[model samples]
Target: MDHATPRVKATLSDEGQRLFDLFRRPQGRSRPRPGERAAMEGARWGRLTVGDTAVVTYRWGDGARPVLLVHGWESRASRYAKVVTRLLELGYSPLAFDAPGHGESAGDSTTLIEYRDAIVQLHEAHGPFEAVVAHSFGVTASFLALRDGVRARRVVAISSVPDFGYVVDAFCARTGLTPRLRDELRHRIERNLYPGEADLWTRFSVLTGAADPRPPLLLVHDEDDEVVGPEQARRIAAAYGERARTLTTRRFGHRRILGSPPLVAAVGDFVSTGAVSGGLPGAEAAR
Candidate 1:
């Protein structure tokens, strides 16, 4: 593929293909919790440097085992507000942060590396964490970090792309890009990696290191989610063997999974025990 790099360069030279490019800067900033706001009539924010980029964010919760709440693509950490409150109420400390180029983080563009490093660093600062509750794109970086050797007791992937190649192909199909750009995208993945990465594709998947199973995982997905397919969630469960458990819901769309009572209960149960709650659609699940 070294010979293919020149053509890859030419393919990405198109300045007009905006859809192929990811959003470089963060969109929404976080707001303080209702209690925090009510108490002080103010909000707080902070920053941490991962690698060279500064990730601006916030932290909250109160429990023996800390939980990291990671938000999805084009979304802020504040979206997991319910998860934070629920975990906190349950006596678990939940730390939420903005991925570079997603929330209030300081960066024009972000990459999977930055996100993974941020999680690792945060875990180091406020660990040893019990689990990481990640959504969408956060799942990608979480997989990379956990697979690459970030210590965690558990990982919860919500609405994640099971395969990076699949997500790329889906985006390529949606944007109507030529197959040639796919090769260039592969080149970008190559660039995204260190000089010695043996396989770019496996390097991006959590499944690579998941087989050994250092930490158990619970994958929650919405069957009707138009964003990330349910197949991804199933693939994740299958990869983890008995260590991974999944619960699918038809009603909650992509964003609602975090706030849904059933999902929250299932996550709570899964974290406490390895068993996953079988809460079918329209069933009465706990809040």
Candidate 2:
């Protein structure tokens, strides 16, 4: 609970001009934790310009068969070091980036539209991708980009956020915003975040769309996830039906699941061969 929440709740009805600013901005950027520095070694680092913002990018191994790795909110590309290592071993190039306001990127705040635009630009440079691997909020951006015509042979969504409303609801719950303030925040996000998109809520959702023969999607989630919850994966699995394969794990929760050795290998296998090599421990597959 940073100082923003209480202050916003206190002054929201008065000097509430920047009420949604904290919502748009991540509270803090993530860094490579100890023993995580090696995960980023031997990568070609560069920057992609999206609407005048410099987004730091990473590419591992030869740029042959490219797979996009999208990290969640308050996370960075280095978070995928283990997966990157596995992908390289499996002969798939892993491409990742620090979304505008996260990691070593240039911005104080960012939006789903910004994330989608960055993905589209990356696709223009290194797509149609072999596969897409995303976590949490990144899953939302990936879905929006796919809806907007980004192509990939397969997708891996870990602890996915199913829609924009879930994001808002979760934030309000965590920040303890008043009901009145929460409703106002939602309206402000709709009107100001990406203006003129009246259908932003429906269009950005994974639950409302049609079954249009999307790429084979692999959905991984923790049964005990404390951040995004297991229902998000269930909803996506139900919506995608036969097109989506789900794997449920325990103990790893939300973030640690990213670096789980078994999970990383599963992702690599799914990306390269379109299947998991060995059945994961405590894994449950949903139809």
Candidate 3:
């Protein structure tokens, strides 16, 4: 039986349905500030039309080995300024895009499928990316894109959720939605957003989809992460077996973990060496 099938059996009131819809839609879309824009002034910028929205992309450096940077929910490509600068210094081309509904991209809200399609479009136009550095929700979309055949030699999943269900659960908890309403919300999401895919949560889950012989993965999580717990990283690492390596940090939290000097250096070292080294401060194995 489908995981959401039992939940959908419960009836929901109109008010509950509306509340669920509101919770599903992303809020607080991030727009680049003057300083952020100025920081990216030297990069070449372009846009790709994905369905009804335009995804804004920025390219830094002229290296043949392209690396993709994916920002998390409610964030923009410019958020990875430090990482992009580091990648450039390491002789790798770093390409980042503002997802639809975030930053300069079009749309008021976007879903995981939309994010996946945007990644695919970018890959088709500017790919085969040597690696992808994805943060939070972007990790889910990036993994889905990889499963759908977006080529990448390696992946760095930073502050990632192991399952899409975690997002729905977090939403319900934050909104105080009743169990029936939560079920109805899942029903509506399945019907409206992912109608063609009956098992979206399972299919989109990195923990479930990651298998043997897949691209090498570097799972990075902060011990003090408030948005997504560090255990999510452990789950993903365990799922990928020997192909996956994890780096655990302290006090960096979720958003700040992206730009942490230690985290950035770890990513650079992983990409450059193709093997994770031991004795790095604040780093630990997943197992």
Identify the candidate with maximal TM-score.
2
Arranged by lDDT with the best first, the candidates are 2, 3, 1
Q: lDDT tens digits, residues 1-287, model 2?
A: 69889886677755344558878889887778875688787789989998889999998877899999999998988999889888888888999999988999999888898999999998999999999999999999999999898999999999999999899899889988878888888888878888988688898886666478789989999998999989889888988988888888888999999998667877977887777644666665554
- Candidate 1 — which residues are off by over 4 angstroms? 1-12, 15-44, 192-198, 279-287
Note the clash tally of each candidate. 6, 0, 0
Write one digit per residue (lDDT tens) for candidate 3, span 131-215: 9999999999899899888999889999997778998899889888878778878888788778899688888788765654688
Please give, for residues 1-287, the per-residue lDDT of candidate 1 as tens digits: 99899886665666324433442334454454453343222124668897777887676643358888777666777667666666766677777787776656766566677788888888777877788889888888888877666777888888886756666777667767677766665566565433456776777776677767468777788888888888887777777787767777777888767677777776676666666656554423221
List where candidate 2 sits over 4 angstroms from the true fold: 1-11, 15-19
Q: Which residue pairs clash in candidate 3?
A: none
Worst 10 residues of 2 by lDDT: 10-19
lDDT of 1 at 95: 78
Model 3 earns a TM-score of 0.90
TM-score of each: 0.82, 0.92, 0.90
Assess each prediction's global lDDT (C-alpha) against the native: 0.69, 0.86, 0.82
